[model samples]
Target: MATFFGEVLSVFSRAVEDDEEELEESEEDEDILRELEEKRQVRVHWGPALELIPNTDHRLHCPHLLLTVGHNASRFVSVFFLSRGDWDAVGHVSLWNERTLQSEGSACVLYRHRDSHMLMCQVDCFVAEDQLFQWTEQVLSSLEPSQVTVLSDCPAAEYQSAQPLGTAPRLRSIHTSACSEPTCCPPVELPNLVSGLPAAVMSFCQLQNISAVVYQCYSDVRSADSTAMDTFRPAVEQLAHSLNLDLCPDQDVLRKVISQAAVQSNLYI
Candidate 1:
């Protein structure tokens, strides 16, 4: 009986091994039909670094910015807000597309509290070769898509020729870290005033001055229900009023921006 049981266990083990082998073979076969990796290069100059920008650690509150850029599947670059208002230093992550920027990708930027008067900015979900198509959307979601500015390596001539634009986004004129820790401040929660709200909202709220805050919210999915907008309208209106920002609850515009964010962030069905 012992010998018979041993034989049965051996057979079962063999069967499991065979199944795993078959699955591996099937996956390998599928890869054979996939597109080959292409080698390309793209130059992304972040304009020029501003040397006179104010340090971030000393201020009570200041604005921050983040950017995501890439051209190919394996090549990508991202910027962290060392200081917003003027000069910036960015860390580049380029393990895949080391040369060109054509692949699809995404990036997001958020301000995390480091300490009492200091803030740390981070970029995440950056992929190079296999997962480049969604980098832009990911970064945008991180940066709050609705608040993003898609900048390209445009020539000075093209920029001058471009249509009218509002004032440029604020950057830190000079930034300094106080013992590598940001000063802590009160938590500020901005209301979700957009229509067709998404399942989850990711907020990047920055405290500027005691009363004003800069926040960007990314939702997991787009809302199809019309009433969803109503639920968030009052919350958003109250938030703006509380913060003293003179923004009216523009349902139509808010809906369009969120919808565009959903698409650009690749929050698709």
Candidate 2:
């Protein structure tokens, strides 16, 4: 290239400018990914009740930990135990993902018996697949529980059986080696695997050598109903007795719980 003054100038390739722009774009993409990863990380936040507990390590000490995953299980616990007003709000787990609606302490709530060493956690939100393990780890790492019991819900179609499934919900159980007591239901068959948060909790408990049992309920309905919630009553009778929870809540309480759920799920309202 030459200027008007007749001075020769070097010509620069436009490809170099294009390469620089591509590099900048790549850096920006990396930054966005890092931010998303950070945002997706699962975290546990303890409530003021836990902070006031007189423990040297400031950790929640639980003799028996009960975890309920999915809407049916959570509602079952709510209608049976929580309705009795014997529990105190302890803490919650927070996570962000595409399906997350309320990351602020409402989705996954932890409760403790007002007079006993029992702890219960009800997870009513949709946890992303990738965040399940992290959510399990962070939530359980803060507590020292001798026995862990998980109640999970699934569609009946997921169950692998030669015979046709009945209308009633079915229960299947998977327990860790440390668990000595027999389960109320049969073990989940091979090739029919459990996934999501329930599986993550079971795996973590097995690796940590904690006595744990997971009761998975397979229901025909897509949404939570009274029948599906009542299906777990027989399976959890012994646990309810041990925890001194009301095995059969009043009809008024049951109606209230079911009505509230119906109101929330009503699309036409």
Steric collisions counted per model? 61, 0
Pairs with backbone N, CA or C atoms under 3 Å apart (clashes), candidate 2 = none
lDDT of 2 by residue, 1-269 (tens): 88999999998899999999999999999999999999988888777766633223555778889999988898888888888888898788888888888757899888999877688999888889999888887877878899999999999988888876698888889999999988888889877898888889989999999999999999987666889988888778887888776688667877887787788778998
Candidate 1 weakest ten by summed lDDT: 71-80
Question: What does candidate 1's lDDT look like per residue over 1-269, in tens digits?
Answer: 24745653323578888999999999987776442342222111111331212222222232222232211100111111222222233322222344333332223223332222122223333234433333322222223221211111111122221332233211111112111222122112223221110111112111111111222222112322222222223223432343343444345544654565466656465
Q: In model 2, how large is the Cα lDDT of residue 193?
A: 93
Candidate 2 Cα outliers beyond 4 Å, as residue runs: 2-10, 52-58, 261-267
Global lDDT of model 1: 0.27
Q: Once model 1 is optimally superposed onto the true structure by TM-score, how far is the C-alpha of residue 101 displaced, in angstroms?
A: 11
Per-candidate TM equals: 0.22, 0.91
Once model 2 is optimally superposed onto the true structure by TM-score, how far is the C-alpha of residue 115 displaced, in angstroms? Answer: 1.3
